[model samples]
Target: MLRISQYSSVSSQQSEQQYVPLKHVSVETFIKFFAADVTIKQVFRNDETKPIEAVYCFPIEEQAAIYSFIARIDDRELIAQLKEKNETQREYSDALEQGHGAYLLEQDEKSQDNFIINVGALPAGKECHISISYVSELDLVENGSRIRFVVPTTIAPRYNPNTGDVSSPAGTTSKYVQTAPYTIEFRCQLEPLKWLEKHPPRKGRVRQIFLLTDGEISNVNEVLDLCRSMATSTRIFSFGLGHSPSRSLVKGLARATNGCFVFIPPNTSVDIHVGEQLQKALQSYISGIQVDWNLGTTVMSTPTRIPPVYANDRLIVYALANDP
Candidate 1:
């Protein structure tokens, strides 16, 4: 059995003799994280006396919590319960089977079901080599009411604040749901979502690429030129969350690449939507669509304009107000 050593081996001998084992030993394990998968590895030693542990590389606190949560129950019972829940949960309709150590969620047509939480599918037996992976449905890395996943999930991922899919502390709401690490106002966007969709992944003889904004630069043309200079085949889906001083120019670059611009306003703090859109992004590979503006109101003079269409199969409302 292996053990965690805090210090190197030590021994002392004077009129008396004393010896102690090392407290911490440095052990390095090469790791690889797939597109939307998790990997867990445990190290073991050949000692029958003490138990070895699965040392984690990051977030010792989170590892401890998962371990504690597992420690409170029966392993076989837990796995059995998890299997039953998985079969029943609608979110994990398609699953990609990998090696014994890992599996990926296949992007199937019915990829809108939520993975069952609290079941603890990724559980580790005491002192065993641990590798657990559930599904994390959302990984678009975008901000706005219409962020879609180009890749489908094996299980229904929650719109969690930590999950990067929702914009709230508890992950509520499903449509017009905007949640990024930052936010950009809708008024500051350019090109509209649909225009970008037509030219995304890359346009023309060139390949389109998505560019995320950290809200740092003041020059949109400069950013576009610099990014394109590195590779001109693709475009950038500029996400504006912080300072939108260069909003107009940013919008222009999107138009330049036949791309689009979106804003994640910092004031928003709740998730309102997430459904069929997830499938739209994954299966359709439709990064986004421009919602058509029809003045259903008394004012009929306004023509059809592409605004950020919120993707929620649950409820598809354009917006409470429209301009641009």
Candidate 2:
């Protein structure tokens, strides 16, 4: 967990609590339904991993969904039992509401009804301070009577709301763990989706873009055209970094393809001037999308290649301002 510091002497009560650094911060506007990710570092068979909170193994990215996180105070063991019983939820366990801020839960009306608990703040030096967090929902972490709610550097098993479950919310208990004729899905990025399912997105609202080239598209223009015309609501964005460095390839591809062209710099030998110039180009491209962005006005975080974001009919690339 990252070391937390700046919680204010802010609130004296839980309802007015916040996500504090050393002390307290507000949970205002942090409510969520679930969360999802690609990386999986399983330390143990039963011991959960915080980096990747996989609720279910989506056979395809199209079958998956996303939700927000929630928090509350409750029994850790009891939460797990409830999740196990609730097929809609992948797995849930304990936290502190008296456990409320410890566990992150879902806020969907369907699953929320299953969680019936009232939470409050813990006292310090005979005085109580409220809890605040970024998760959609939360529970306090209790050790005996002490509350160690926010541990930034260390993460325990938490809930994510982005992915859908195996069952429907309206399904009967006996048949609850099954998907009927209903399911809402969004496409995940290629790498993240690959982490969840061996295959990529298909069916539902996902649009499949087929590359006709026998080999990988070496030209950015050719790749961009394929993405632009073929991508539709769901399009494919392609580029390569290994053998050839083609500037024309990227520019043309970006123009013809529906997605942006990206070039990743060499890790060990990338020249500083070249790297900085490339950063400017990428920033300018992204800024074209978001009207308020200033590509060269300020010393901003340089834009880096982004993994694609998939939805029923789209594949979006979020060019982050950092490296992997």
Candidate 3:
């Protein structure tokens, strides 16, 4: 996913600003055994009348390790190298002062799952091409029988407190203009090994499901009962989006399956919560969990059956006492 904006002074009016537009995007992934390698390429163009700076924000998997980053402008190609943040910022500023094109990339201050790139001094009608590559371990799902890989292609809007409204800082659209159409290409390759063939995956066995919905369902009780029946075989993580989602249905499904639920308010980003859930899903879990209470014989718990406990995850238990 990509979010792009134009760099301008704070004094500039919103109607006078123009943003860089995305031209093309390409993605390729290779999977071998339990690991995956991914590469992404994106092109941007400046169609404004004057030279402008471009800012792009993108997200990556929390467990991924980026190994390569390169930028190409016309006949020149530059490779990124790790350096001190302050030193790199100083150098980038100096390049812009000297009337030279500069590119700077850094992780976002507030979130480690996102990155920001600055392209300075791009003249009108010019183009910039960026390519990035990274590797990550595939997550095990379906009771450790299958692997799952995901690529996020969108970022939710955020609420701004000062303006009392929703806003997107990295948006490509301005108040008076909208971005042009862009093209995307994607491909994936998988290689099977001898060991994988020996232990083939079982069909029709879904161990986990992440459900995100923004609307209400009419058959809430039926869905809850279905999830409860599959509790021993499957775990369901539910997310309710926007203000219109039915909280009772969303929470009931997760409770029945002994999973987790998240409520995303209107105009809020789901990246942080989604990342946290993904990490928990990938960790080792302790099954057949049992809780013993020493308070008294009158003590009773809401959930008589304990759910599977994951490593490094918090667990909450609710209990009620007839006598205090």
Candidate 4:
């Protein structure tokens, strides 16, 4: 945390403007095969001579399960617990009105991914740190060994045509970008496939091609053609980034190779988004899975519906046994 202390006393005639209390924010993420964990730390300081409050708005994954929130005011630490939305709001309001250092965390009803954090009543030259933690499942690529992970840094604006309720959740929308100063796009060349062809899949091995894109591509057919040729030898998993990436190209590539595609929306926290997409993709897998059981000589097994299962995935089986 950084503090600003250099300031000259203002003249009585000069009017003083409000100072922005937010200093900076830092985020860290850790990801594994099946899950992603994130920690966010925000620093707020009051540089002015009077007490003030600071409010920070941010976004997280819609599916994220936040388990911990801690507020540090110098040496004193306050851990926030889960409560009803209304209860949490009231408590935070009361604390702030009473001039106590209060920290509040709440999710937006309109969008689960959006969040508002309030730190109330910091005395002059004082600072506070807010820490948040959450966990979400990681998404599995079409291939068993490889997975996809993302951490969103920004939440792009969304358009709302209806005017009934104009208010939106925090971090939900912002000024839209009509034309970026410049645009850069990347595509797969498939030149690597030739190298892989020389060394074909042997034994029980699997080949995978993972694609991640943030924008639309003009040459969807060409990419599909290459995927079609390599379908027998490879599986391609695709991810569409941002609000409206090219669905045709993403799905077509995956479909051509008998793989899967997942669309990532804007305003999604990157790591959480990656984890959620991977988890969703893994859930779609229903092929090449089996369940086995061993029973006594006098026992018999009943039939049951077995959903598609895949390798390295979890399956729960329920069966009825009777005497033979």
Candidate 5:
């Protein structure tokens, strides 16, 4: 999952919120056994009259490794190359000064989970396509029966005391003409589950209840207790809407039922978030999961006990092998 924020320059004031209009985004994910390969393509257009350097910040899983970054600018394609940070920055600045196009990808200084992309000297009215590809090991969950993968779609705001500025909050509506009705296309392909072919399908049942509200619950304690009692038979997905919804109540109900929760700010579309929840609800549940270790050594695994795993989600487990 990727979240993006755009700025005119790297040195621009963080308080000044300026975003380049996102025209389209396409994501393709391929899953094979315990690994996933993901590719994301994003198109951004320059509407300002003058050429501007664009800065984009995005996040990925801490364990995910990125192997490719490519930028397409009006008949020219540039592939990113690795170099010392200072040297790369110097070359990027030189390219801008010489009126040439340059692209730079670097890990964020403050956080390893985040990355920064610089697109230098994009001319007015032009469009650039940025593609990023990465591969990550999928986690086994539900006693090693199901595989889970997640792509983050949101970036929470952060305050920087040094700059006296705050990172832009997620879910802010875009005002660009092209972005007002932007669309994101997503596709996922998974390898066939050989175990399913070998064993009979289980007769499992799933009961789902969706709750959407502005978080104005009167009997909060009673409601939460009721949700907790229904955990054995029901899954309650909750959505909190508006500016001042009761986050505690909304999140509590979902937590009690072992479900999911989403918070939608004012003026943002509700369908997208709802659709995502619906997709998760529709995944088939696999049961009777078991893992067999055959290595000739004593192995200790963190999370000595397995946690409940959701369908199509990743679970990471660390193991240490001890020689006999």
Candidate 6:
């Protein structure tokens, strides 16, 4: 499985003694060619009879270009204009102390991928929604074009190798995760590609199964076993959505079936373009692709074995040149 570091973490504590403030987070991403527009809506409610304040620390992609930020309390919405970091912090603090509801969004100074959000002075039974929007570009990769989007639902414990950095809260302890009164439900609409299901009626050829899911499956091992049994007939391609997916399960299935797995984040739009791209890729799919180098030419190439390559896929070759 590929490893990506510095992603947003959502707290998930199974213990009952922890206090969780934030309720639900809804993220919408619209992809346009190489660029994508992302919007994140965070809802927090004061379940208690008394007024309360909520603060949440999260992460955003380091390269994302954020443009809009707004806070909504009941029907009254407050648009946040860009200000100096210190000025913004002071204003938000003053608003909260005066019993007025306020919201503050800032980037973490120490870590490029970390962010902090402060939602304050929520009245009893009142709900606050904070929406943030940004735009970012997608990169072209091997095996045609691949796009990856990630949303963190759980904050994992961090291990800082550097201990001298006391200016930032890099080593501070965090709260545990528990079920909140307000539940967050995320829905993803996938345009089914029927072409993936068709298998060429020939020897040593296999059909591809694209499995798309936003949650974990209970029978992961069983599903893997089934895929192994059908290894001769079909190839399994697994896609996990959101942040808290079962990484082992998704990667295991692909590894077992000699296929590929990908995790899609909340900032990517799997719209009509996705389908068109898939169609283009499938049309260029070659069952068994091999590379041949000149024999006895004192040449060497890494990866020694080449996987299946599509027509649009870029073939990268790395070699070491020696003096004759």
Best by lDDT: 3
Task: Write the residue-wise lDDT of candidate 5 on 1-324 in tens digits.
Answer: 222233234343332235544689888999898888999898888776666566666666544678999999878888888789888887876665567767888876544445777776778888999999999776443334666676644333322223333232121221211121334232211112122223323347556778786653323445566666656666778987765454455656676776776777789998998887887677654433445566688888754544345655545566677873
Candidate that scores best on TM-score: 3
* lDDT comparing candidate 6 with the true structure: 0.55
List candidate 1 segments past 4 Å from native.
Answer: 1-77, 80-87, 90-116, 120-131, 134-191, 196-210, 214-324
Candidate 5 runs further than 4 Å off: 1-17, 159-324
Clashing pairs in 5: 1-151, 1-152, 148-313, 148-314, 149-313, 149-314
Q: Which rank order by lDDT, best down to worst?
A: 3, 5, 4, 6, 1, 2
Task: Compute each candidate's TM-score over C-alphas.
Answer: 0.22, 0.18, 0.51, 0.50, 0.48, 0.46
Cα RMSD (angstroms) for every candidate in the order listed: 20.7, 22.2, 17.1, 14.1, 14.1, 14.9
lDDT of each: 0.29, 0.26, 0.62, 0.58, 0.61, 0.55
Relative to the true structure, candidate 3 reaches a TM of 0.51
Residue 52 displacement in candidate 3 (angstroms)? 1.2
Error of 3 at 232 (Å): 26
TM-score of 6: 0.46
- Runs of candidate 2 with Cα error greater than 4 angstroms are 5-10, 13-101, 105-257, 266-324
Model 4: lDDT of residue 87: 77
User: Candidate 2's error at 55, in angstroms?
Assistant: 20
Tens digits of lDDT, candidate 6, 105-153:
7875534345667665567778878899988655344345675555444
Residue 50's lDDT within candidate 5 is 65
| lDDT tens digits, residue span 199-282, model 2 | 434555533232211112222232334344433345333332432233333333333434433344335343443343344333
**How many times do residue backbones clash in model 4?**
9
Sequence-dependent TM-score of model 4 = 0.50
